[model samples]
Target: MSRSLSIIWLFGLISGFNIMITGNTLNYWLAKENIALQTIGLLSLITLPYSINFLFAPIFDSLRIKYLDKIFGHRLSWICLTSIALVFFVYILSFLNPFDNLLLFASISLIISFFSSMQDTILSAFRTEIVNKESLGFASGIYIFGYRFGMLIANSGAIYLSIYLTFNEIYKIFAILIFVYLILLIVGVKYFNSFNVIEEKTYSSHTSSSHLHLSLYHSNTSLCHSRTSLCHSRGGGNPVNNINFIKRYYNHLGKSLSSYILKIFLDSRLRGNDIGKSENDLSLLSFIVLILIFLILYRLPDNFINVMINPFLLHLNYDAFEIASVGKFWGVMGAIVGGLIGGFIMKKKNILDSILLFGIIHALAHILFIILKIYGKNSTLLFITIGAESITGGMTMTAYIAFISSLCQGKFRATQYSFFSSMMGISRSIFPIISGYIVVNFGWQNFFLFTTIITIPSLLVLLKIKNKLQQ
Candidate 1:
C-alpha cells in the first residue's frame, strides 16, 4: 500500500474518535444541559456536511494552494489544513458552554462537522488512488476497525479520564492530541512526497520520445514546453493558469460524461463512456437510483434511536459513566467484531446481497432496544441490546460503504461518493430531528416500532435491483 492509503487508515481513527466525541462520548453532557429534546435531536442537522460535501468536493479533488502543496503535496496539504481547521473548531467547542450558549455550540458543531466531512472526502479520494475496488471491503473493514477503536477509547476513555479532569480539560486534551497528530502527519507526508518527486524525476529522464509524446496527448494539452508539467501539474508559465486549466479539464469531462448521468440526471442522452458504472450494473443509472433509495432508508432505525438513546438511558437513571462505558465503549467493541465479520462477508458475497442480509439484521437489531425499553435496566439486557445493535450496525455500514465505493465515478470519485453519501445523510439527519417529536409524543416503544416499519421501503428497493447487485 502507498503511504497515502496508510495515512487514510490512521485518519479514519482520528475521524472516528473526533466525530464520536460529539455523538456518543458527550451524549450525556449535551442531554444533561436541560436543552429542549427537540433541539438536541436536531443535532444531526449539524452533520449535514456528511450528506452534502459533494457541493464542494470538486475543490478538494482539483484545486490546491500552490505554495503549500509544493511542501506537503496536494491531498496531504488539504488533509493537514482541514485537520487544523477541525482542531480549531473543536477546541472552540471547549470554550462554548452548551448550557448557556446552546445555539453557538450548535453552530460550532456544524463547522466542526464540515471540516470532519471534508477530511473524510479527501481521505476517500486518496484511498481510491491506491486501493482496488474489489479490495475496498477489506480496506473499509480495516478502516472501520481502527475507527471504532477510537470511538471505544473516546466513549469510555473520556469518561474514565473525567474522574481526574474536567470536561473542558478533556476537550483541551483532545485538541492537543489533534495538534500532535498534525505535526507527525506533516513529517510523514513530506518524506513520502519527496520520495515520489525523486522517483518521478529519475524516471522522466529516461523516457523515450514516443512515450513522452503519448504523455502529452494523455495530459490533454499541447503547450507543454518542459517535462515538469507532464507529471507535476499544468502550471506551464504561471501558477494562475492552473485554475483555468482545471476548469477546462472538468468542463470538458462534464461534457463527455456517460449517457447514464446525462440521460438520467440531465434529461438528454449523448454517447460517451460509462463514467460510474461498476461490474454488475450495466445501467449505472438504474443501479444508482436503486442504491439511492436504499441509502435513504438504510439506517432510519439507528438514527431515530441515536437521537434519543442517551436521554432515554438517563431517563432510566443510568449515569454518564455507565452510558459511556456500557453504551459507547462496549458498543464499539461489538462494532469491531461486526467489522471483522462484515469484511469477511462482503469479501465472499456480493456487495448488495451482503447489504440485504445485513440490512435485515440491522433493521431487526432494534428489537433488542425495544426489549430494553420494555424490560427496563438489567445490566445483562443493556449489554445485549447495545451489543446486538452495534454488531448489525457495523456490518450494515461495511456493506453499505462497499456498495457505495462501487458507485464512485472513476474520475470524480470524491464528488460522486459525496453525493451518494449525502443522499443517505439526508435521511440520517432528518429522521433524528423527527425522533425527538416521536419519543415525546408517541413514546420510545412506538418510535422504535416505526423505525422498524420504515426499513421496509429500502428493502423493497433492494429487491428491485437484486439481480444487478451480483458479483
Candidate 2:
C-alpha cells in the first residue's frame, strides 16, 4: 500500500476505540451525576444508529455535487463533512450533563454516535476503493494493528483518566483526537492527490443534466441472469439480447453449482469492468452481493457470542480489571501479533487461501468460549482460554479483513464497502437482540454450541466459491 493508503486505514484506530469511549465515558459520567441505572439502560439504545448505517449508504453513492467534488475530491468532501459534524457534536456532549436532561443528552449522544458511525462507514469504503491490490494484505494488517492499538489506548487511557479527570475533561481530550484524525486525514489526502486516482475526460454527450462539467465515466451494465456472462455492450448494445441467451444459459447450467446464488457473485468478480476488462474488475452487482454474504455470515457465530462476553464474564464474577487484562490489554497485544503474522502469511500465499485458513481457525476458536462455560469458576483456566481464543480470533480477523478489502473495486467502493461493513454491524445487533432468549431457553452451553454450528454455512460458502476466486 502507498503510505497515504496505509495512513488512511489508521482511521480504524478511532473507529475501534470509539466502542471503549462510549461504554466507559457514558457510564462514568452518568454515575458521577447520580443518574438512575434505568436511565443508563435506556442510553444504551443510542448506539442503534451504528447498526443500521447501511440503510443510508446508498445516498452517498447516488448523490453528488460537482462543486464539492472540485474542491475536496469525490469522497473527501463527505469525509470532511462528517468529521466536522462528529467533532462539533462530541464537543457539545462534553458540556451537557445527562442527569440534568436525559432526553436531550441522549439525543445529542445519538447524533455524535451517528456521525462517528458514518465516519467509519465512509472510511471503510474509501480505504477499500483507493488501496492498491498488491497491498491489500499489508493494508489490512496495518488497519488491524492500528485498530487493536486504538482499543488498548482507549480502554487503558480512558479508564485510567476517570480516576483523575472529570467526565467533561476526559471527553474533551477524546474530542481533540478527532482533530488529530482530521490532520492525519489531510496528510493522507495530500499523498493520495500526488497520484492519479480518477481520470476524467470531456465529451459532447450529457448525462442527467448539461454543464461544462462531466461526471466520471459510468455506463449501464446488467446482471445478465440468463446468460451468466458479463457481456460488455456499453452505450450501444443491449444487456439482455446482445449475448446468445440460449448458449449462455446452457453453459451456465452446465456447471454444477454448489450454490447458484452465491457463486454468481464470484463469477462476476472474475469478469466485470467499466463495460470492459479494466484492471480485471468485478461487476458492481457481483461485488455488492459477495460483500453482503461475507459480511452477514462469515463471522455471524463470533459476533453472536461477542455481544454477551461482558455479561458472561460478569456472570462468572470476574472483575473489570481482570476482564481488561485478558480481553483489552493482552487481547490487543495478541491481535497486533496476529495481524503481523497474517500479513506475512498473505505475502506467501493467495488472499483466498489466507482467508480460508484463518476463517476456519476463527470458527474453531469459539470452542474455547464454550470451555469457559464449563470451567466458569477457574480464573487460571479463564486466563488461558481467553488468551488463546483472543489470539486466534485476532489472527483470523486480520486475514478476514484482507479478504474483504480484496473484494472492493475503486469504482463504487464507497457504496459497496459501506454496504458490506454495514451488514456486519447489523448482524451484531440482530443476533444479540435475541441472545437473551437463546441463553434463557437453551442455557449457555447449548447456546454456545449453536454458535459453533452457525459458522458451518460460512465455511461451506467459502468452499462453494473456491474455484471462482481462483479465477
Candidate 3:
C-alpha cells in the first residue's frame, strides 16, 4: 500500500512540475528576458492543449504503442511514452533561445504541453486502475500533496533559484528530475501490473469498450431483423424495401455514432441511457445529471472566494509577506492536514456520507472569511480564517477527486474522467470572472456572504442523487 501511494504521489508531483514549468516558470522566464507584454500574453496559445486535450483523449484509450503497450499495460504505456517525450522536449527547449528561435521554441513548448496533458489523462486512468475504490480518497490526498509540493518548487523554488541559476539551467535540472522519476515510475508500474488484484465495479452498463461494441452490434442486428421482416411482408421483391432498409441502416448508424462521440464530451451516461431500457426509466440519466450539477456547483464556494482572496487581503492593508506566510506556508500545511483527515473519513464512512459531511464543512468554512473581514488584518485571525478555508478546500477537493474516480471505472476511464475534469475546469474558470464583478458591485462582506450561500445548491444536488449513485 505504501509503495502504491508513493507511486501515485510521484505521478501527481511530476504532472504538477511539468505543467508549472511550461506555464508559470516559462512565462516568468519570458518576462525576465524583457519580452513584450502582448507577446507574453500570446504565449498562452502554447498551453492551450491542456484545455482541449480531451478531444484527443480517446486515442490514449484505444490506441496502443508497438513495443511499449506490450510491456506496460495500455494506459501505463501511453504514460511512459508521453513522459519520455515531455523530458526530451523540455531538455531541447533548455538549449533553444526563445528570441532567436521563436517559432521553434513555441512549437516545442506546445508539444510539451500536448504530451504533458496526455500524460495527465493517462495517469488519471492508470491511478484509477491500480488503486482500489476504498483507497481512492487517501490516494488522491497523497497525490494532491505531491502535486502542490511540485507546483511550489516550480513557482517559488524556481524563482528563488534564479538568483544563482539561469532559466536554461533550471529547465535542464527539471528535465533530469523528470527522467529520474520516470525510472521510479517504471518500477512502480511494473509492481502494480504484477499484482492484478485490485478490481473495481463498473458504474453503468456502458462502462467498458466491449460493452459499447456489443450494444452497437445488437442495435444493428435488431435493425436488420426488423428490416427483413418488413421485406418479407412486402413479398421480398420490391426495390423500395431495399432502399428503405439502406436508409434506415445508415440513419441508425449515424445516430449511434453521433451519440458515441457526443457521449465523449457531454454526459458519459448518455450512452448508457441510449443503449437499453433502464430498470427505472430516466433514473440513470437523472442520476448522472444530478452528479454533474453537483460537481459543477460543489466547489464554487471555494473557487469563488479564492479568486478574490489575495486581492481581498491586499485590500485589507495586509502586506505581501504576511499573506504569503499564511496563504502559502500555513495554508498549504492546513490543506495537507485536511486531506489526510478527509482520507480517514472516506475510509471509515461510505462515500455519500463522507461527501455530505465534507460539503457541510466546506460551506461553513466560507464563514471564516466573513469573520476575517470583521476582525481586520490581525495575523491570528487571518491565520485562523485562511487555515480553515485551506483545510476545508483541501478536504472538499479530495472528496471531489475520489467521487470522480469512483465514476470513471469504465474502459474509457481516461476519456470519461477527462470530460468530467474539463467540465470542472470550465466552471472554475468562469465563476472567478463573476467573482470580480461581485466584489466590484456588492462589496467584500456581501461577496463572502454570497459565497457561503452558493454552497446550498450543490449540497442539495448531492442529496438528490445520493441514493442513485450508491447503486
Candidate 4:
C-alpha cells in the first residue's frame, strides 16, 4: 500500500478498535461478570458524547490549539491530543473494579468515550480533507477494511485472550498498543503533512443560499400562515394590515429562533443561517435535516443487535474462544470481503442504490440470529450466521461512509461531517439502551425479529429522499 493509504488504514483501525472496546467488548465483560441486563443496557449512556460531539465540531474546524497546532497542524493536533488522553484513560480504566466502585468505573468509561469521540471527529475530518475526490472511494474501502480488522481484534481477539488473561490485563495490553500508534503518529507527522492537500481558508460572514434557505423560509412562512389565520379568526378591523403585521412579527421571531438553534449546533456561517436569503438556502437546510434523519435511522438494525450479540452467544454455551474465533475473527474476514464487494458495486452503481441494496441485505442478515436461536449452540450454524451478518454489516457500513463523505462541503467539511457522523452515532450510542431489555423480556428470537422489522423505517426514509440523494 502507499504511505497515504497506510496512514488512512491505521487511523481507521485504531478508531474502530477504540470504539469497540468501550461498546461491545465492554458489554461482553459485563455480561460475564453477571451484571444485570438493564444495567448493561444503561451503559450505552456513557457514550452520549459520541452522539453529541457535533456540538463542538466547529471548534475543530475553525479554532486552533496553540502549541499543538504549530507542530501537528490543526486537525492532527486534536487527533494526537485526544489519542493520548483516550489511551491514558483506557489504561486507568483497567485498574477499576466495576463491582465495587461502579461509579468510578462508569465515570472513567465516560471520559474514555469523550476522548475517543473527539479523536474520531477530528480523524474523520482529516481523512475527508486529506484525500482528493478521485481516490476517495478506494481510500474509504481501505479504511473500512482496517476498521473492521481492528474491531475484530477488539471483539474476538480480546475475548480469546481472556482465556489466559484478565480483562484488566487485556485492557492494559490494548492501551499499550494504542500508545504505540500515538508514538508513530508523532513520528510520522511530516509524512502525513505531505499528503495534506486542503488549504486553510478564512471564515466568511456571507451566507450562501441554497436548499437550507428554502427550508428556513418555508418554516417561517408556515408559522406566519398559522398566525395569520389566528388573526382572521379574531375578526379584527383592517384585516389586510393585521395579516401583514402577523407575517412580519412571526417571520422575525422564527428567524431569530432558527438562527439561535443553528448557532448552537452548526457554524454561524452555514448557507442557510441568515433568513430570507433564497428558496434554495431554505431547501438546503431542509435537505440537511432530512439527511441527518436518514443517517440516524439507517443503522438501526445493526446497533440494536450489537449490544446483545455477545451476551446472547455466551448464553448459547459457546466458550469465549469459540465466540471470539467465529464472531470476531471470521466475522471480520466476512466484513473485509463485504467491503470489497461494496466497492465493486459502488463502481458499477450509484451511491444511493448501493446503500439501499446493502441496507436490505443488512436487515435480512438479522434473520440468521433467529435461526441461531433455533439451532441452539450448533457451532457450524453460529459460524454461518455471524459470517453472513458481518458481510452484510460491512457492506452497509461502507456505503454509509461513502454516502456521508460525498456530502461534506470543503470549508465546513469537519463540522458538517461531524454533524452527519454524530447523527449516525445516535444509533450506535442511544438506541441500544433498550436492547438488553428487549432480549430479557421478549427473548432472543423476538428481539431479532423486532430488529429486522425496525429497519423498514430507514428504508422508507431512504426511498423518500431517493431523488434528492440521486441529484
Candidate maximizing lDDT: 4
TM-score of every candidate relative to the true structure: 0.76, 0.60, 0.59, 0.73
Instruction: Report the C-alpha lDDT of model 2 over 1-471, residue by residue, as the tens digit.
Output: 357545645666867766556654464456457564345434555666787765544344334435765676645667778777877877888887777778888888888778777766666656655555556556655775677667677675665565667667877887788778777876777555542343121111122111111001111221111111111111112223323433443465456433333343333343243322332234534534554676678777766665556556656776556665765577667766676677667666665566678777766777777888887767787777676666667677765665554444433333334445557766654544555567667777887788778777777777656644444
Comparing 1 with 3 on TM-score, the higher-scoring candidate is 1
lDDT of 3 by residue, 1-471 (tens): 888888889888887787777776676667566554445545655666776765554456545567875576556677778878878999999998787878898899889988987887667666666666567667867887788887777755775567778888988988898888888888876765443332223212222421111000112111111000000111122345435544553453356533543454343342233322443434544555666788889877776665566467766777545654675567778888888888766666655567788988877888888888887878988888888888887788767776665555334455455556766865554545566667767878999899888889988888877655344
RMSD of every prediction = 8.7, 10.8, 11.9, 11.9
Best by TM-score: 1
Model 1 regions lying over 4 Å from their true place: 1-9, 125-142, 191-241, 245-290, 343-353, 406-416, 467-471
> Which candidate, 2 or 4, would have the higher TM-score against the true structure?
4
Off by over 4 Å in 2: 1-12, 19-81, 91-109, 121-145, 160-173, 179-295, 342-360, 377-379, 402-419, 440-443, 461-471
Candidate 4 per-residue C-alpha lDDT over 39-150 given as tens digits, one digit per residue, 9 for 90 to 100: 7877888878878865545445445567986676666778778877878899998998787788898899899888887787677766755555567668867887788778
Residue 59 lDDT in model 3?
Answer: 54
